[model samples]
Target: MLASLLAGLGLGFSLIVAIGAQNLFVLRQGIRREHVLAVVAVCTLSDLALIALGVSGIGLVLHGVPWLAIVVRVAGALFLIGYGLLAARRALRPAGETLAVTGPATDAASSASSGTLTATRRRAVVGTALALTWLNPHVYLDTVFLLGSVASSQGDGRWWFALGAGVASVVWFAALGYGARLLAPVLATPRAWRVLDAVIAVVMVTLGVVLAVGG
Candidate 1:
């Protein structure tokens, strides 16, 4: 059981540590002072629900579903391509300096700031999170199928494994959201956004091709 617990922790952490669109959105939102709590809650809740469902025999069912993976892969590919295009668009935009004013600030100081935070748009934050979670078929495979298969292998201890993984989700999302915010000063810069968007584009395209090929 101790070994199983450690295995579960390692698996959970490994899966969650990747820098994907979801993590980027969460990090940007945390820095922007948007609904960080809501974002974290929804992300954690979604993962918990999916992980629990996966552990409860759904994993076996999913494995038996013929061509479902192919369909998901196709859809994921299109989604990633679209997201990559959007990131590329952002990358092509003009760069500028921005202020990291939170809550309220002095007028003189605020005036001295020359740029606007385009990423601070609240709707974009929420929408990006939703897209990263729901549109990415890899998420389903990882949490619902892969994790589920592993947990179910434990027999009665499957529930414990799921619980442990779910707890990890909560901890990870909370930390990623709030923790990234601590670097708001650097992350709020236009150059930083461009770099991030470029990275996102590359990651999305790579994941898309991998999903489409299914290799």
Candidate 2:
């Protein structure tokens, strides 16, 4: 069980820690501190459900439906491209920086609605997070097919393996979502934000273009 648990943990971290669209989005939300909890919840729960499905042998079901992945890939690519363009616009048209400025907001209600990580955009953030997670076929490949195959190979310890992977999910999301505040100081400048968003636009757009072209 220990060996199985370690194997699952190692694999889970290795697979998840890669620079993917989902991770980048999570990191962005973390930095923005907007709907961070909601974003984290959606992502973590989605992973848990997918991992459970995989360990429970839903991979067999997905294996028979190859077109499902293609559909998701196409949809995801379109969404990502649009989203990247939006980010690029934001980067170019810089909003007043919201980095660690220590002062009480003038109006609580206004700040809640207008600030970077405010409640007004909660719905949008969650929706984007879901699309980023579910629309990407790579997510299915990682959580459903790859994890399922490896977990099944663990014999009776597959559940234990799943458990370990689940733990990894929790740890990674918690650290990423909650731990991103550490960058507030460094990201306090509008210049920093421009750079970050510019990079994000490139990554998101590039990935979308590649996926669309079946690369």
Best by TM-score, which number?
A: 2
Model 1, span 61-128: residue lDDT tens = 53577455455446646665666676767777834545434542235464446435433544565676
Worst 10 residues of 1 by lDDT: 97-106
What lDDT is obtained when candidate 1 is compared to the true structure? 0.66
Q: Tell me each candidate's TM-score.
A: 0.57, 0.61
Give a tens-digit lDDT track for model 2, residues 169-206.
Answer: 98988787788767545555677767767776776676
By lDDT, the best candidate is 2
lDDT score, residue 179, model 1?
A: 81
Cand. 2 Cα-lDDT: 0.71
Cα deviation of 60, candidate 1, in Å: 6.1
Q: Could you tell me which residue pairs clash in candidate 1? A: none
Task: Tell me the whole-model lDDT of each prediction, alpha carbons only.
Answer: 0.66, 0.71
- Lowest-sum lDDT 10-residue window in model 2: 97-106
